[model samples]
Target: MLLADGIHAVITDRHGGISAEPYTSRNLGGAVGDDFDAVLRNRHDTAVELGVDPARVVMMRQVHGRDVRFVTEPFGDDPPPLDAIYTTEPGLALNVLVADCAPVLLADPVARVVGAAHSGRPGTQLGVVPALVEAMATRGAEPYQMVALIGPAACGLCYEVPAEMREDVARVVPEAWATTRQGTPAVDIRAAIEAQLHKANITDIRHDARCTIETPDLFSYRRDSRTGRFGGFIWLDGG
Candidate 1:
């Protein structure tokens, strides 16, 4: 899906890479017990498909909080610790790793900028999207001109949260209760993120119906205890 004008990006599944066993085929995380070479290869292929230089795609260690970083240029070496990333520069891709957590791609076509965020329970509880929005605005993005794509994530139907976790979600937005669709209480992370988007005045929104946990093609941390991660990346077009 498209987030901003002149921007192209996609979220990948776990079925097309070279990793083996628990990582299976397309694991993109180097720190999750997968062979580093396998994760590197998957990352390289993913970048090629998106027309980005593997080196320009910036990623973070992902501390699962509300931290967001606005990158004016690609990282020189190791990435910083952050949950969300935004960049206005063309050819610089922003990547966020996830298994069951939500990956959000944000864009302001008019500004020619894009952002990607890792939103699991912890990041959601910490308000990562809102932080991303504010960070993008500082780089000159306006909410009305932004389009947000909530990609494949753990669906509420398959994501049964503990009662305490549900209560934490409720504390953020009481309306989150409406997303509960089954016997076991689930959190519609997309809905919760969308609510945050609306609050920020970002109206363009799209939600992919794929559930990473229920679907075998993608990776899921909760579904498979030793699973690898799939990545979501975006960048402004060059040439």
Candidate 2:
């Protein structure tokens, strides 16, 4: 969906590229064992489709922790280890790669600040989503004034986990606690993240609603051990 003038944000599905096999056509993840050149070409082509320069894309190593960083410039291919990337500077887009994890895109049109985040069960339990909101707040983005887009992820019904792990995450985010389709304990990472954003007063949120594990059009690391990752991007226009 179009966020606003000068703000470009979108979530890519696992299609429309040149990778083969498990990666299929569209694979934005570089470290997922896809051919380096194919991955690079797919990334560049995706950026070109978005009218952005491939070199200017800002991404993270994404350690599934609470580390959030601000971007004033590009960091090339070797991005730092962090879960969230925010930018007030125009022309620099933030990209978040995900397989079963939630990819969050933030935009505050009034403040001209945008951010992208990758959050899984660990990140949800560790308050990474709130940290990204706080980072945006420091840059003049009020929580209520911003809109967040939660990309596709493994749903609660499909994301079964250990009983202890579910209990651990549920302690912090009760909204995430759930039972899988087969009556197994599970954690809905996206639901937990949305709850966090709501607690921070960020109520304007959208969701892609596609489950990675259930959708063949999207890649799922849990479903395919060698799967490639799709991505979501957020940016402001320099012009």
Candidate 3:
């Protein structure tokens, strides 16, 4: 998807690649129990399909914190534990892997800045998406001029949580408070993220409404404990 004049974003699903059963095919996450080589292959293939160099794709360790980094190159074999990364360099695609967590892509074409963030329950509470916006602002990207794409994740109706847990998250993010379809407590991570983006003054927001837990084509840790992770990739068109 073209996010702006020269910025592009892509969200991957479970179909297409070679990771085997549990982590079957197109699993871009290396930390998962999938074969190392298979995960590497999947990453390479996904980058190629996106017209980006595999060597240039920057993947995060994603500790589900609010740590944001301004990266000029890939993190190599040992990526730091971070939830968000922004870059001013063109063609260096920032990758965020997730099963049920929200993968957020942000870009300001005029500033030539792009960022990707991993926002799960903890990350949302920590305000990772807002942190990413701040990191990108350091490179001249303004919140009002930026566009955001939120990828597939567990929806409120399917993301049931303990009553105490929901109340705790809602204390920090009221928009996260929700009730599941079965009338149980739930936390709407995506809705909370959207609210966060709006609070940051990013009005141009798009979303892939597919719920990971309800969508079979996408990996969902809540639905299947042992599952592969898909990726949300964002990059500039030229180097």
Please name the candidate that would achieve the greatest TM-score relative to the true structure.
3
lDDT of 1 by residue, 145-200 (tens): 99888888887777788777888887996545434466877677767888999999
Instruction: Output the TM-score of candidate 3.
Output: 0.99
State how far residue 111 of model 1 sits from its true place (Å). Answer: 1.4
Residue-level lDDT tens digits of model 3 in 148-170: 99999999999999999999999
Model 1 segments more than 4 A misplaced: 178-182
What local lDDT score does residue 16 receive in model 2, on the 0 to 100 scale?
96
lDDT of 2 by residue, 49-70 (tens): 9988777888789899999998
TM-score of each: 0.94, 0.97, 0.99
Among the numbered candidates, top lDDT falls to: 3
Considering summed lDDT, which 10 consecutive residues are worst modelled in model 1? 173-182
Sort every candidate by TM-score, greatest first: 3, 2, 1
Q: Compare candidates 2 and 3 on TM-score and give the better one.
A: 3
The segments of candidate 2 whose C-alpha lies over 4 angstroms from its true place after superposition are: none
Ranking by lDDT: 3, 2, 1
